[model samples]
Target: MNTSPSVPGAGRRTDGSSVRIGALVPLTRPGWVEAGRHLLAGLELAVRDVNDAGGITGRPLELVVRDTAADPRRAAAAVDELAGLGVAALAGEYHSVVARAAAARADALGLPFLCSSAVLDALTEQPTGRVARLAPAQSHGWRIYADFLLGAGHRRIAVAAEPSVYWAAGARILRDHLAPRGGGVTELDMRSLDPGAVCDELADKRATALLLLVGHPEPAVSVVKAVRRDRRLAGIMIGAPAGQPEFAEWAALLGGDGTAVPFLRYLPERLGPLGARVGAALRERLAEAPSFVAYEGYDTVAVLAEVLRSHGPDRARIAGSWPQVAVEGTRGPIRFSRTPGIGVWQWAWPPVQVVDRDPAEPARFRVLHTG
Candidate 1:
């Protein structure tokens, strides 16, 4: 069957020895490489575990990985290539916009895709059974974040957002959820302004909470620094619902400044038995405590393996099997169904938490609220 490939995202074996699962991840620049690394690690670990436990119907389960690099066109192209390469099904992607493009392409081609981590509510333009997602939808998780903002006694919210469909969708979710409760969202265009300007606007608007819908490292880091150092916005709470601060790079760059900024994470307060075992294994593999995205990666494979066992690798069979999937994922029981507003089959939700790094212990995450 499948021999575990030494290098992730490398070409798959063409000898017809393995049952292939096409993986799309951001492995290079502009792709949030750290997150991608964790995602790949979990996928690889699960693939190895699957093969060890007797690969699907006796064929080694192989992951034919492709780097989407946070680009939609690149992801679409990868889907086509993977489809042509004879992969049985598809999995993995971090960025919501890139995942949407990949999902659209896969659905059009009649390929089965179990998305690991992208949470945008509208994964496809129309309802389709070919694609399913494990992460909570953007509307579901982000509205919870908006509720957290309101709960923390912050009503006047300002969003420092970059120009992106994903960011725009997040802004809409926050706005729509908050407005009914006497809350409002003010959007600051990051296109024309710098970090100093962002701080100045937060002060002028008297907004108590500034949610960062911007990119990581550059402008987001800069804005956090400016606001943290500025006396005028001393009482302002910095937030990142997009979860830029989840990775080590954010902490390395900003350190304590990055701590205590709430972000959406898909996990419960405590890991169950399966989750605990998986987390320990992932921690050993990664040499660091795994992020929740890593668990999503593992759970993606867990569900797919069960599907492939029950329904063969045929695309139509796999596509039709989302409703039948019932696997014990790392986080919880994994299953899929049509959600109210979501276009594709969706995991009604995984555990959603608004968490922040403990300022007292920068290495530890503290759960602020659970939704």
Candidate 2:
């Protein structure tokens, strides 16, 4: 086996024919550990399948896993370490804060980084040829949310947002989209008030819907529970764009209340042939229902493999080739677009759905809208 002397975490195949790729994920964050686990499963499954199918250019693909714990500093260090390990490419990250730092480091090192799930709008703002996002940016997803609410005739909306870059980006997009139509958002700082008090205030405003932009699952669940308490607020629709699918724990936490609470999701019920194949592998191996994050992880690897197949594992060539890449990914056709204000080389269309947890089966959800 061939191993790097400078990087301790580097792995190599027993036969000594392998390409190392770095995986940066949070494994110990208080609220994000489960999300990290699911994403890791997807990446592992993809590597397995890729290797089985003859690997990247006949060289086995090995992942050098790093636990980021969602910290920016740690994430940046992980990138530097992965580069020192001689990884051909980098993939996998969930938190936007961590992704921002890792992306900068990867670019500085001249390595190709395919971000799996971070949605911060500013992530791709500065065009670094080294970075590309597998997931849609926050602004894109929020615009979808805004259109969904407006289509449903919700004019007077109230937004409960967490004080974080991730949440703030989405909130700003929603506000911009709604303002032009004479529909505006009443903003509430989730950190300042109790969940009950926030819901009560929204009820007083006679808000037609409540848009939650919280970063974690716990606060999102708390807000949903509080809104369900007021029978008078039954008419108000509750939607959370950022917390869904990853926050599967909410189903058990909210019980019956989890039903009919709208949240954004990327995975659809019907997985295509490629998605079905990976989904089956994930279920059998992980013994858990595959989430959208898993799909993202799988697709991230697939994209990197394509880059290697075409560019021969040279980081600069792989990074430079992103603009011309158009691969059929697990969700759909993956294509990157360069738009002003959005990140550089960002996926233009990532399949998304508005789903509500099934009332009878809290663990399951039903798709209410799709775009």
**RMSD (Cα, Å) of candidate 2?**
3.7
Candidate 1 global TM-score:
0.96
Best by lDDT: 1
TM-score for each prediction?
Answer: 0.96, 0.92
Number of clashing pairs, model 1? 2
* Alpha-carbon shift of residue 191 in model 1 (angstroms): 0.4
Q: Write the per-residue lDDT of candidate 1 for residues 1-371, one digit (tens) a residue.
A: 11225423323322246788999989888988899999988899888778777777777788988998899999999999999999899999999999999999999999999999999888899899899999999999998998899899999999999998899999999999999999999999999989999988999999999999998777899999999999999899999998888888999999999999999999989889989999999999999989988998999988898998899889999999999888888888988988899989899889999999999998999999999
Instruction: Write candidate 2's Cα lDDT for 1-371 as tens digits.
Output: 11222222223422345788999988886528878888888888778777767777667788889888888998898888889989888899999988998988888889889999988878844678789998877777778778888888999999888787777777778889999987889989977978988878897889999887775566777888889888879788888777564455666577787677777778755879988888888878777787888889989988888888888878888889888888888888888878667656888878878777777877777887787
Model 2's TM-score against the true structure: 0.92
Clashing pairs in 2: 124-343
Candidate 1 overall Cα lDDT vs. reference? 0.90
